[model samples]
Target chain A: GQQVMQIPQYQHVQEGEDFTTYCNSSTTLSNIQWYKQRPGGHPVFLIQLVKSGEVKKQKRLTFQFGEAKKNSSLHITATQTTDVGTYFCAISFGNEKLTFGTGTRLTIIP
Target chain B: DAGITQSPRHKVTETGTPVTLRCHQTENHRYMYWYRQDPGHGLRLIHYSYGVKDTDKGEVSDGYSVSRSKTEDFLLTLESATSSQTSVYFCAIRVTGTETQYFGPGTRLLVL
Candidate 1:
């Protein structure tokens, strides 16, 4: 079994400020995927990172996978109200079965 | 939003009752999964189906069972519902070769 934990259970930032959430796994992971769940909405796929120390960017968002493959991070630059949601990091167990992180709920105040 | 639909968007049941939640997909995906979301536990997988008649238990499979009789449908059943089972349940689908999962609107279940 694999376990993924996320930091800063809840984050509140100004609309123009930057924010970051981290995900750590108890065991080594082959790859990590990120998802975003808006309030009262379903989780939506954002991106996936493979290989050690991989980094990918989606517009204003940046995602990184640690060299050890046991940790990952999602950083948002200049957050906006549309960015308020729960961000989750999911890891697969040698296959397509994904284990999701605890999630970091982000709130942006204008 | 990926042609996924979960029935009875919300449900309220008493303890020791049998409840079944249905997940229907129009995408005809090979992989379908059932997940429960709580306040602090994030999303935990309960069961998943790889094919019409093939299903596997997930990490949180206890007290939950799933059946997939057709390619477009997956059902999650609770033999006897308990209060601890109250949570938001989501259904996700993934294509044969993709790692990304698209989710249904979700079903919120409350067991009293």
Candidate 2:
């Protein structure tokens, strides 16, 4: 009964440009996880944000959780060609199952 | 890199056929999950197993079933596959005491 909606279903940017994807949930979340799926590859766990208003960064990628814990965002600075893939935001409501967002497919122009 | 492997990386079958996908893990995790990925629908959970012989349905479990007979093996079966079942299926395992889930390589099934 939970829904996660992601914005900019598909995005294409120049090789050196930046990109951002937003994830909004209908209800507050206990925790949110970000995953990256490369072309022809499986989804890999990137990071998890449990505390409200938390921010985490990995290399050029930055992840932020909204203060209300109902939304999150992933921003990539100076994207590279290798950054082409779909980024998904997943949330769990104290259960074993995770509800994933529709996902944002990112493409980088070389 | 969780030592998770899926059998038959790619499969093509006809409608109404019975198909089964296997997920093998070396981590011996307690929780296993099966999810289907479509074009617009990111990853919809089909089923998940908490332990051996303990399973539950998920958001999209109508036509899919799963079994975890052993701690390292999980199987997803499609009794009567349909064209709508043509999609990539991913199997994941949740690390003990953590919410992080590691996914397998995935199985691409095409129902014609």
On DockQ, the candidate that comes out on top is 2
Tens-place lDDT digits, model 2, residues B79-107: 99999999999999999999899999999
Q: All models: lDDT?
A: 0.94, 0.95
lDDT of 1 by residue, B1-112 (tens): 7799999899999999999999999988999999999999999999999999899989899999999999999999999999999999999999668788999999999999
What's the DockQ for every one of the candidates? 0.87, 0.93
lDDT winner: 2
TM-score, predicted candidate 1 vs. hidden true structure: 0.96
Alpha-carbon RMSD to native, per candidate: 1.2, 0.8
Candidate 1 lDDT by residue in tens digits, A1-110: 67888999999998999999999987888899999999999999999999899999999999999999999999999999999999999988768699888999999999
Across residues A1-110, which tens digit of lDDT does each residue of candidate 2 receive?
98999998999999999999999997899999999999999999999999999999999999999999999999999999999999999999997888899999999888
